[model samples]
Structure formats: C-alpha cells, structure tokens
Target: MSEAPWWRGAVTYQIYPRSFMDTDGDGVGDLPGIIDRLDYVASLGVDAIWISPFFRSPMADFGYDIADYREVDPLFGNNDDFDHLLAKAHSLGLKVMIDQVLSHTSVEHAWFRQSRESRDNPKADWYVWADAREDGTPPNNWLSLFGGCAWQWEPRRGQYYLHNFLTSQPDLNYHNPDVRRAVLDEVKFWLDKGVDGLRLDAINFCFHDQQLRDNPPKPEDKRVGRGFSPDNPYAFQYHYYNNTRPENIAFLEDLRALMDQYHQVAAIGEISSEDSLATTAEYTRDGRLHMGYSFELLTDDFSAAYIRSTVQNLEAQMLEGWPCWAISNHDVARVLTRWGNGDASPQLANLLSAMVCSLRGSVCVYQGEELGLTEAEVPFEALQDPYGITFWPTFKGRDGCRTPMPWNNGINAGFSVGEPWLPVPAEHRALAVSLQESEPGSALHRFRAFMAWRRTQPALRLGDIRFLDTPEPVLAFTRRHGDETVLAAFNLSAQPVELPLDGIAGATPVNGHGLAQGTFADGRLSLPGHGALYARID
Candidate 1:
C-alpha cells in the first residue's frame, strides 16, 4: 500500500489556458499567465496540473486541433515560456500534464496540407482518405460529433477525408505505421522536455474502421447520454465504426511502451464512444493507458442512486485498471449548474468536490470549480465556440462553461485588461478569488481546506470503497486501507435530512474540513442543507 504510484488516487487540477489568466493583455491566457499563477495552484493542494492544449492551431476548435505538435502557439508565447512555466511549477511541487491531441490535426498542418494535395504523394496516405460513392455522396453514414457528415471532400485528391470532429480537424491515419511513428515522436518531444503526464484528448478516436462501415441506428430512448443531445444527428447512431475501434488497443499498447521509457510520466485517456464506461475499462486494462476517464458522472443525473449505480458499474468491471474521475472539464457545463440544478451553493460545491474526491480513484478538478462558478449566459453574437454556434438555441454548445476566470471585480474581472475572448459573468466576479480568500466560508476556502485535510487521511486517499444502501438524497460509503477505515455520508439536497446507520451504527466524528458539517449521535446522522459527515470507523 505504501508503494502505490503517485498518480493512484491523486488529484489533478485542470487549467483551461485561454480562460485561466491573460498576461499580454491580448484577451487570451498564455503560458506566462499560467506561470504567474503556479503558486496559487500549489496552494490548492493538488498533486498535478493538467493544462489543456496550447499547441499551434488554427483556433477552429480552439487548441484541440493541433497544427504543430512540436512548438507552442505564438498566441501562448514561445517554447521558452513553456520551459519557464514547467520549471516554476516544479519548483512549487506541482507536476505538469499537457494535452496531446493525436487523433486529428488541424487542416493547416503540413501533413494534412500534403495529404490533401494528391493521391500518390508520400504523405497522401498519412490521413484517412476514401473515394466518394458513384453518386458523389460521402462513402458512409458516419456522422461528425460537430454535426453533418464526417467525410469532407478534397477536390485535389478526388477523394474525401475523415474528420470525427470539426472539418478543420482532419483525422490522422493510425493504420499507417509512419503516422503512428510521427505521432509518437511528437509525444516523446514533450516527455523529453520534462512533462509529468499527458492528457490524451479523444484518444479512443485515433483509429477508424478500415471497412468504412455505416453505424447502426440508435433507439430514441438510448440516445440520451453524456456529451450527446437529443437534437444532434450524431446521437442517432450507435457509432460502432467511426471511433473506439478494436485497432486502438494495439496503438494504446504502443503508446504505453513509449511512456514506459520515461520516469514516472503517466497518460490519462479521455474516453467517449458508444459505450464509454466499457471502453474506459477496456482502454485502461493491461499495459494500455495508465488511467482512463469517461463522461459518466458529468451528466445531468445527480441522484444518489444514479451515482451509486454508475460508480458500482465501473468498479465492477475496472478490476485490473485505474480510473480518474472528473465532474467538469473544458467540454462540459459547470458541475455547480449541472448537478446542483437551480439551487447551487458554496456548501453544495464543496460537498460535490469532496464526494468525487472520496471515490476510489484519482480526481481532476476543473478550473474555477473551487470558486463554485456557474455556467455563463453568453449571447450568441459573442460566442467563439463553433460547436455552440452550430447548435445555437437548443444546445448552446460549451461556451457557457468556457468563459474567462474571474480573479477580481475589476474590468474583465481582472482576467484581462483587453476584452476577453468570452465575457466574464457578473456572478463570477462576485465570487472572485480575491473576495473568496477574504470570506471565511467561501467555496474557494472550503475547497482548499478539504483538499488539505484530505491529504492527511490515508484511507480516504488510497482505500477500497464500499457503498452503503441509503435512501434518496443520502449517499453513504466506507473506505478502508490497512488499519484505517473512514465512513462518509452526504445530503445532496438543501433540505435537512436524517439517515439511520444500519449495521455501521457508530462513528467517531472527524471535523475541520470546512464543509457544511453534520452530526452523528445515537444511531442517526442529522445533516442540514448540503451537509457532509466523515468519521473514523474504528
């Protein structure tokens, strides 16, 4: 137990660069801005910082569409700025993890530019290309997650290229050994430069079906899942061919072998497919990915039963692999708004963070989550996200959660002197870090306290979890490791509730986590309005 890997059950803070801070007054956050805030991140007691992509891109899908894998985008400063950031972050005891988007590259990339030019070019086979049907339509019924057809016609090559996401992000041909070697070289460049980990975005989408098969139609009731809306056409199919292919397993093993060459560097893949939980389990087992996370808990379902079933389902299958949990990320709506429904609060925010961290795995805390920031209501006219713009009224895209971080009540909420890429919500300004640091019971302070206290509890950090059968609104579980066992319970709603501990009746209260405290007396646990309880079992 003492020899467990550092990433096992560790907490990683996800920093969305464009919205984190702005140093050059360009209304965009850069690597230097992240360097300026390293101390503040370290103060939160997280083991590592997972920075979203800052690689060279066309800004089509923000930074997820990489144009140049070896260099930092000029918008984010040069490679030197990143070196300084890595050094400063390590000095503050924070490990750094950068995003690696290997599934696709920006159309502006050299490989894609060449691949789209001609059929016989050396790089022509570097991308997924196929001839159109005799009727000049797409080769298959594969749909893009961003809506419409997955294949974009290339006139120069007299063929169509595949793109699982935006058309500007052309999918790479992992079937080609040269492409795999090139992608691995790009990944090694970062590891050689001293990165602690890699957050593999769309890692499951690297390989496509060589047969170009059409996906089966999905039932109406089965279409509702995380990241998929009922209105989008992508939800209409089972997505058996376009992504999460069986070929990805071998690629993952190749990735792991490359990562094994480094010291203590880990890789966490973001899984999204027809069956994400099963894919998460499959991609993480054996020597594939070091860890994997899916969109299971990031959905609109916040009930105890739904949560219990989701976690238990993953636990039942992921026996040989490790998992990482994230309630919110750059792609989804904020958890406070998503999980809290309409009654989000500081107490609720801290409670949700603790509950997720208490699970038997590592955790990823999104930026501004500690401040309990809700989704911003960005107007359609000012929206920058192409996804949101394409799905405007009904879906509203992910812009609500991608707004700039509010550091103060000043103009642009002290995020930038220039106009921000996305407007900083006035509500977020009220909960700025400066103001929250002064307030004793603020979400920021409570999150910090809970994380600090969580570091001291070995059972909470590295123990095996066993859930207790409880009624609605009350979620209870026990964590045991070595000689220590801790019992935890949370009331999801604001209304006061009481639960009678059945067989595990008695608990010695462990306080000072700065959450909404609950009381344990006799055989009953009384919790008032989003209250939580933690106690030693023995």
Candidate 2:
C-alpha cells in the first residue's frame, strides 16, 4: 500500500471556486480567496484538492464556458494568483487538480469568433458546424442537454454550430486535426504550470458521430435512472451519436501520452453517456486516464442495494481501470438532502462520509460536506443558473448546491462582505465552519477525525472490497489487502437494525473511527441508527 500511487485511493476535496470564498468582496470567490483558505482545506486531511474551473470565461455556464484556456479570468485573479494557490496547496501536502472543459468553449473564444465569421476563415471548421436541413431546421433531431436543439444558427457562417450544453458554449470538432492540436497545446499550458492533476469535464463529449445520425428514442421507464430527470428532453433519446464516440479513445491516449511526460501527473475524467458505466470502464482502461467517475454514484439512489450493485457492476467491468466515486459536487443537489429521506442528522452525515469513503476506489468529497451542509433554497428571483431559469419549479438546476459556502455565522455566512452570487440560506449559517470548528462533536470534527484515522488503516484505503450478503438498510463488506482483512458494515437508515454475521469468522470491533459504533458479539451485529462498524477479522 505504501508503494501505491498517491492518487490510487486518495480522498480529493472538490472546491467550487465561485462559492468557496470571496476575498475581494465582488460577490464571487477568486483564486486569491482559495489561496487564503488553503490552510483550512489542509485541516480537512484530504489527499488532494480539485478546484472547479477558474479559466477565463463569459460566465455563460459559469466557468464551464471557457473563452480562453490559458488565461485565468480577472474575476478569479490572474495566473499569478493560481500559481500562488498551487504552491501553497503543495506546501500543505495537497495535490492540486483543476477542471479542464475540453469538449466545448465559450462563443466568445477567439477561435470560435473567427470560426463563426465565415465558412472559409483561417479557423473555419474549428467547431462543429453543419448545414441546416432543406426545411431550415437543425441538421438532426439531437437535443441540447440545456434544452432545445443542440444547433445554434450563425448568420455570418450561414450554418449551425453544435452545443451539447448552452448556445454560448460551442462544441469543438475533435475530428479536425488542427482543432485537436490546438486543444492539446492549451492543456499543455496547464501541465507547464506544474498542476498535479486534471479533472476532465464532459470528456466523452469530445467527439460526435461523423454522420450525425439521429438518436433512437428511449423507453420512458429507462430515462430517469440516468443523471437527467424525466422532465429533460435530453432524456428522451438514447444519445448515441452526439457523444462517447469511438474516436475519443485515440484522443485520450494522446492526452495520456502528454501526461506521461510529466512526473506523477494524473487525469480523472467525468463521463456521461448512453452507458456511463461501460464508458467509464473503457476510458480508464489501457492507460487512457488515471481514473474515471460516472454520474452513477452521484444520483439520488440512497438504497444500500443500489450502491452495492453500482460498485459491483463497475468492479466486474473495470478490471484494469481505476475508479473514482463522488456523492456530491458543484452540480446536482447535495447528497445530504437527496439521500436524507426527511429525517437527516449529523450522525447520518458522518455515516454517509464513511460509507462512500469506504467504497473500493478513490473518492471526491465536495466542499462544505465536512460540515454536513444540506442543499440551499435559492429563490427564483435570486437564481443565476440559466438551466434553472429554463426549467423552473420542477427541476431547480444546481444553484442550490452552488450557493456561497458558509464559513461562519456572520453576515452572508462569511463567504463575502458583498451580497453573495447566490443567497446563503439561514439554515446553512447555523452549521457554518467556524461554529463546527468550536464544537468537537460537530460533523466537521468527526469528518476530520475519521479522515485522519482512515489514513492509518491501509486496508480501508487500497484494499480490494468483497460485499457480504445482508438485508436492506444494512451494508456489509470486507476489505482485503496484503495479509490483513477488515470488515466494515453500515446502517443506512435512522432506525436501529440487527443482522447475523452467520458463518462468518470471528471479528474484533475496531474503534477510533468517529462514527456511531456498532457492536459485534456472538456472531450477531447490532447497529444504532446511522451507525457503522469496523472490525479486524481474527
């Protein structure tokens, strides 16, 4: 275990820079602010920090719509600030990873600007431009993930450009050798900056079917299980042609080749497609990427069986590829509320953290999760996400999760002196970092204590997981590595439960982990509500 790569089983803390902290009081968090909070991030005892996009952008989809890959947006300070942040994070023993949105770029990007100018410009065909059908409709029936057709008309070019997301974010044509070369060079710009890793955003969307074939209609019953809701038109189709094309394999190899040149640099791609699990397996196989995470674990399924099946499915397919799991992120509602089931508690939060971390893979823990922050309620009047504005009451986009972080109980939860980009809910203020830090029994303290303790257990970190058969609301597994075997079990509900360890070998309860402890005696295991048990098999 000591010889394993630093990222093999690391717990990465995902920091949403726009909501992390606002040092300049511009109502948005900046790189300098992240740098200032590096100490606090270090205190969490995480192995790495994955900062969401800070690249220059027009804020069309926040920083996802990048106008320039090489420049840091003035809203987030210049390259100097990022350099300082990186240096400080390294000094604090935190590996730094930045979001790399390669599949698309903002409409304002110079390449897109020139490409949209005319059909034969120097940068023409830099993006996915297709002629409209005879009826003047979009070339195909493909739908944008942000609603409406994926194509946007350009009067200057007399053609439509593809945007898998918002209209302002144009998809790059990876088929174009020049475009691929340019994007690779842009990525190299970061590698040159000494970044330890890259969190690839929508990496599977890099290529579209060259023929632009229409996607097949999906069965209504199958639509909701994926990341999108039933209300989203995007879930109506199987989405075969628009993304996760065969061509992406080669490009990922090229990316991996470039990364191989650097020392211990890693890449973890975010994948969403028709079969995200299969694609996650393929993308991480054969040295394509260091690790890959799909939206499978990020969904609203809180059932113990679902979690077991999801991990087992991937484990069966991803023989050679490493996997990364996340329960929450800048996108989607926070896992606490999504999985809380009406009655949630600090004990439940601690159990959830332990459960996800104990899974057989590296983990990404979202910011404010240490304090067990639930989803915020951002009103329509204060909403900034265009996706939410487009899909009102039914689907509230990701603003609830992207609201400014609560650092303290002071005004605006100490996120900023100015009005926050999204209003912080009064509920979040009560669980602010400062308040949690003062109370040793708080979620924050337990999380830190667990993380610190987790480091001492090598089997929990890199051990191979074998799930044991148990009834609902109880998840039991054994982690085996080297000559050591550790048994872990969790109660996934707010009510007490008892299960028999029938035919199981003797186990001595391993204490020191900060969750509610369970009892193991006479081959019977008793767990309190939201309780977890860890034992070393004798």
Candidate 3:
C-alpha cells in the first residue's frame, strides 16, 4: 500500500464548487462550505479532491474566467477561507489539488488591463494582441469556442486580443518569457499555500502560433470535440496554429522542474487537441506533465469495441507516460444518461465504477456519481451555462449534469439553506446521502466498499491489460503482472452469455457488489444478464 506512486491507481473526486454546497445561505458554494464537509468528502475513500476555480471572476463563465490569480473571490470567501479548507482537507487525510487556468485569464485581469492600455506598459506583451488587417477584420481566421471570431478588437490599443473561449477570457501570450514567469509565480502562490497538486486547465492552449497563421479548414465530417463543441465550425478547423504548439514543451519542462522541488507534488494537464491522442502522449512523456487525460471516453459512443480501442491506442503510444481516465466531469454529461439507455440501472453504475478502477491509469469520479445519479433536466430559463443558451434545442449544453448535489431529502437537498445556484433534481432527493447512509446495499456504500476492495487488488491496479476475443455484449480482459493473473469479464448485454476460458488456469470471483455468479467447467464460464465477474486466475 505504501509502495505505489502518488498518482498511479489513485481515485480523485472533482468538486464543482458552485454546486457542491453553500454556507452562509449565499446560494453559491464557497471555501467555507467545503471546509465544513471535509470529513464527509474523506469518508468517500477518495485520495484527493480537485476543486474547480474559486478565484476572482466576473461569473460570465462562472469561475473559469479568472480575474485575479492571487486573491480569493469574495463570492467564495477570502484567502483565509481557502487556507482553512486546505488545513481541514489535509487533517482528514485527503489531498487538495486546485485548478490552474494558465492558458487564459479574465479580460479584467490586471495583466490584461495593463496590456490593453496604451500598449507601452511593462505588461504590453502579456496577452495575445495583434493588429487587425486594413479592412478592420481579425488578424487571422481563428474562431472562438464560444462562437464567432477568437480575436476581439480593443479600441484603446488599436489591436485584436485572442480569446479561445469567451472574449472575457483572453488567451495569454505564452511566447513572452515575462508572461511565463508571471504565471509560474502565481503557481508558486498556490504551492506556498500547501496544495498537493494542480489540475492544469486547457494546458495545451497556453501557447499558440506566434505568426498568427490561419488555421487550415478541416473537413466537416472530420471534426471532433477535443474540448469545445463538436458540431460547431470551431471543430471544423485543424487547429494546428491555435493550440498544441512546439513552444509549450519547454514551458512544461519548466513547470515540471518547479514541481520537482516538492515531495509528491504532481500536475495533470487537461489536453484538448485536434490530435488529442498524440498530444496526450507527448505532453506526458519523459518529464513533462505527471499525467494527461483526453476526451476519449467522454463521448456519446458506448460499446465494448470503442472502449477497447481507446485504451489499446494509449497503451501503444503512451509507453512510459501515465494517463488519467474519466467518464464524467463538470464539462460532460453524466455517463449513465449520455451513454446508457434512459432507464439506467444501478447494476450498470456499479459495472462502470468497477471498469474505471480496473483501468491502468488514475481515475476521476465526479460528485454524485456514487449515488448513480443520472442527468437532470434544467428548464431553459434556469440554464446558467452560456454555451447551452447559445446552442439551444440542438445541444442544450452542460447544465443538466451540473445540478446541485443532494445531501439530504430536505429542501434544496440540504446543499444550502437558501435556494441553490443550480436547482436540485426531484429524483435525486430519494438517493440523498442521509438515506444512503442507512441502506447497507446503497450505491454510496457500495462505492466506498468497492474502492477499499480495489486498493487490495494489485493485478487490477498496476497490471497490463490483454483483451480477449469475445462476442457482442461481452467484454473480457486479463490483467497480468509477473506470473500473477486476474481475469475480468463483463456481460454488456441484458441477456445471459457464456465465456470460454481456454488453456490451464483456475478462477474464483473477488466479490464486491452482488453481481451474478457463474460456474466454470470444461473451459466455459456461464454468466447471467447484467452480470460481471473478477476472478483470481492461477
């Protein structure tokens, strides 16, 4: 237990602060609210918690538009509250990892302000600003993820500033060394506050083509959502110049060097690239990021083949680098609702949890996942996400899955005394923490038990996966480590299936959840519908 690397086989829970909980009846979750629930978070058996931004912002994109790097937003409390939360989390034996949005900052940030003002200030080159063409058009043909042109004209500076997302979050000019040093100093500010690690937001987008070259148009059919909208034209471009530049590698090396100064301090980058697989491998290779995760499993597709191919591709390319796997997060829909048929079963939830834990890389479990909570419906008027508002009907955006966490059956699910910023789903109340605490077989209890059990299986934790040839609705794999082997089989369909086990080997089920049991004889193992089995093979 003491021998594993800090990140390998670790389970991290992501907390979207605004919806997690709220103290002081402010309707928005704050640092104090998180501190109050430190014990409850630790009881879930997660190794660490990745809290989304609580820095000062204009709330245009919630806290993602960071206005100030050092000060805590008054909406979320001050620096003292953050320090208190850190101490409380560490006291409960839980690690704290803050989200760092180095790629961009709020247009209102002091650096952006100084950069936009007069253009001769010391911070003039801090943000990506370039002169417009003679016709007053943008400098280049780059589109913003929030729709329209990625560059916005600043009348005072007589230039266009680049914004990958909202115009409020202007992209930083990473080509400038002064900007890099300033960003690192902000990183040091959090490290000095005793955070164990950092979750680098949109890490690859930190640097772009300094020449401002036009991104070649990609075929409409060849687009995928690396992070932004897949259906939008933003995805229709190759994005060769906007992100994942060669300049990012040296900055990553500098970042790694800084983290190496502390014991067990790690950094995981959120890689959103047109060539995400190649970039994920490169960003994590050697001494770059400690790990990087892409949108491989966070899509609408859900099949045994897709899952197998994604993992196999990473295994072939990543080699020595580490990967982090996540099915649902703040930006994506809940897997049960997005991938599963509308009527999601508790059995499938248990199966998905087991599957993610069995993967070779680390895992991130979003809040309310333990309850097997599916996506909730938020009325158009109640939708706070700008992305959803802009692309209504066709794509409702991420608000459905970003609802308030259910803590009790009481009003507002006990997330706050006042009305929560996001509405709590009526269906989620029955699966509240208070109700699940009393039920022995509840998903919440099963999550804790299964996580504890997973810690004991070294084959599942650090072993290589060998996919077995199997029929539809059946996913089989063997995790092997130096003569020790474990066979994991899943009946993906709603009907029974029999798996043939060839060669000389013995097996026994490592029961966690009360999944179906099968008897094996003459190299054949019989399984029932919605069944799964993990066996110690000898």
Cα lDDT tens digits, model 2, 111-222, are 9999998899888988999999999999999999988889999999899999999999999999999998999999999999999999999999999998999999999887
Clashing pairs in 1: none
RMSD of 3: 1.6
- For model 1 the local lDDT of residue 100 reads 97
Q: How high is the CA lDDT of each candidate model? A: 0.91, 0.92, 0.85
| TM-score of model number 2 | 0.99
Give the higher-TM-score candidate: 2 or 3: 2
Candidate 1, residue 57: how far the Cα is off, in Å? 0.7
> What digit string (tens of lDDT, one per residue) describes model 3 on residues 119-183?
88998988898998999999999998877889999999999999999888999999999999989
Q: Candidate 1 local accuracy as lDDT?
A: 0.91
Q: Kindly list the per-residue Cα lDDT of model 1 for residues 23-58, writing each as its tens digit.
A: 999999999999988899999999999999999998
RMSD to truth, every model: 1.0, 0.9, 1.6
Better of 2 and 3 by lDDT: 2
**Cα lDDT for residue 473, model 1?**
96
Q: Which ten residues in a row have the lowest lDDT in candidate 2?
A: 221-230
Model 3 ranges off by over 4 Å: 226-231, 502-504, 513-519
